[model samples]
Target: MKFLVLCLIALIHQSASQSPQASCQFENSIDYTCVLTLTNPNGLNNITEIEVNHMPNRTNDDVVIVRTSIFSTSRNIPSIICDTFRNLRSIDMFRTGLTKIDEDSVSNCKLLELMTVRFNQIADIHPNAFAENAELRTVQLDANNLTSVPENLFENNKKLVEINLSQNGLAVLPKKLLSGLSELRGLFLTHNQISEIYEDTFADATNITSLGLGNNSLTYLPDKIFSSLYNLLDVYLQNNQLMKFNPYWFQNAKSLRALYLSNNGITYFPEDSFVNFYKLRELMLDRNPIQKLPGKIFASLGELTWLDLENCQLVYLDPSLFLSTYNLWMLKLANNDIYELPGGVFGSLKYLATLDMTNNQLQAISSTSFYFHPDLRTVRFGQNQINAVDEKFLDVVNVTQLNMEQNVCADGFWNDDSETKELFRTELRVCFENYIEPPQYCPIGNEYERICELEAQTASLTLENAGIRRDLEGLAARIEQLERLISSSP
Candidate 1:
């Protein structure tokens, strides 16, 4: 009778521990055979880690879970499996086979800060996976196969900083999924299948510096997609299906220095596509179907130093293409159908160090091609139509390899701008009393009210003067002063 009474006690405990109503759906329905029987090894008060099947019968809400470590080498954790622990700090069940996450269990792990469950079988996580977990700042799921992310994913965890969901199977990123994580800085969504994002997806990430969205199916982007990433410095948009480019796509990316847009379907970007990206340092545009490059293609890419334009059908370009790119250091225009190159095409590159024109149809080069370079290091005019060679050619400052293997031209033409461009620098700096930055064509930079104010003042003053716009002397004078001030600024 004593033995029978003990068995009855065990049966009662097991039933109470295992009878939670299933709210989250699983991939398959399987009968649970887990019977919990927990015994604190160092007494009932000092234990740390416990097996999921050994959750002793208890109703206390203050069980301080130090380490809820799984026993097996496998790392997948069940959604509602840690029902025994109350105040867990860190859970490391990564690479496990977790399927569904019980949203209610989030309140149990109130102090959880770090969670690792990558390479798991979790295809769907509850939208409120971190609803009540306020202290969870880092969550890593680098190799998961999640297909969709739902809204309210981090609705209330306003302190989250780093989230790594890269190398996943995502298709479309949900709206406002990161709505409450306003303090997050670093986000890595590389190597996924994400294709859609509303304009406000990055609305709250004002402090984000680096964002990687490479290797995806993104075909289009809104004008204000990076508006909230004001402090962004590095951005990767490679390996996508972008058909066209827009100048306003990066309106607020004022601080971006490095941009990668290689391996896309862009045929020919507008010459002004990068006009606003003034401080850009490196640009990578390899392996695209770019057929026509505008004469003033690199007009405003003033800060570009390293440029890669390989694997494209670049045939014709204006001799004054690199006029504004005066600080270029390395240029790679190889692997294309480049039939002609003006002798002085790279004339403005005062700091040019290396030039790689390999596998191109280069015919000839003249002394004026690279006239004023004091630091040129290497030149590759190889694999082209080379026949005639000037005795005075290859006498550059520091050119190492004079690759005249395949080129047939008497001498490349030099349409050099003999007029010194730096002479106008002094004329624009003349003293003006009320000098201001000139109004630009950008909607935000130049408002309609400013135009109205100038028009009204000019009309009133010109009534006593003459009809010519120049006769509206004060108005024209102010605009000229503002233009000069804007031009002289850094």
Candidate 2:
């Protein structure tokens, strides 16, 4: 019995000396080893989340995986970090040249919880790539070249919180994809070719916070899309070919905060497009082909602050549109064939600060076009055939760049003589030099002031022209830096 005890001690010593290859996800020096006895590698891509930068490095004496994939690399790229711990928690193989990984290849890493395989040219993934490791939290497969997903992909992953498979080639998601993932938080499928969504998409996620399906080809949504998701906050549906919208689309998502539906073929938006999203803050409808909007299109969104309507086919618009939201800030109507701004266009938006009417055809600007109580800041008239601009087009706020360079401005709008232009020049010079982030001011204060100041200052300014330094490609780096500094300062 004494001889047997000595032999067992020798065996244990030998096993502890042979250190396995490990990865450190944090900035610590602690070492870790594969805790194989406690780990079950039967789950699909069994990953132990080691949030790098987001989560401080774990410094336990036992080996721990450091989470640092996103801060270090993009899709499918591999990197190495020194480790002192005996256990690894997260493995990021995202965008690296890895084609496959299964339980056999990763049998040595017994404590992995998360794996990032995004944007790789991977065509196949084994079903049992990961097993019953419970400490995993996230698996991101965004922008990958995946053709399909295997069954029981996340079978025994109890701690997995988020699964990002967006921007893939998923035609229709499998029903049992997330059956075992009960605590998932986010489901991202933006920029995919998913033409339809069945009720099974939300089967496993009870605490989903955000669902991104922005650039899909879906014509309509089924009723059960948000059946299991009670905590959803945002839904992105931009760049889809949606022709008609129904109020029942988002009837269940009552806690939504933002909705994006820009750049689609939506000709008309139903008044109930925002029926259930009571907490919505921002609504984007830019670059759509919508020729008209429902009289109360934004009636349901009481907290709507910004409404983007650029590049839409809005030949005609109602003047008294904004009646519900009292906190409206910005309204964009650029790149449309708007012939005139109705006198009561901004009658409802009493708190509007910025109005971007850029690249639109307008014959004239009247003082009554704007109803802001000195709250308006910047207004763009660039890329437009604006025939005239008077003092009514702007205000004296912070900074303003009324881009009417090509527009036909009547001559002698500033002063009959050049001496009065000096006073205007001082005001614009002081305003721009002292103001913080590019501000908006009265068109009279912005345009005439800039023209006079630059005209006077241009005569005294002298420096090496950038056109003269194009002789050598070798010295472009240093020359570029010099050019930037000179251009940025006054």
RMSD of 1: 16.9
Instruction: List model 1 lDDT by residue over 276-346, tens digit each.
Output: 77888988888788977776767778899999888877886566677678889999888787876554566
Name model 1 segments beyond 4 Å from true. Answer: 1-48, 51-72, 78-112, 389-393, 401-490
Q: How far is candidate 2 from the true structure (C-alpha RMSD, Å)?
A: 16.8
Q: In model 2, which range of ten residues has the least summed lDDT?
A: 35-44
Residue 193 error for model 1, in Å? 1.7
**lDDT, residue 218, model 1:** 93
lDDT of 2 at 105: 43
Best by TM-score: 2
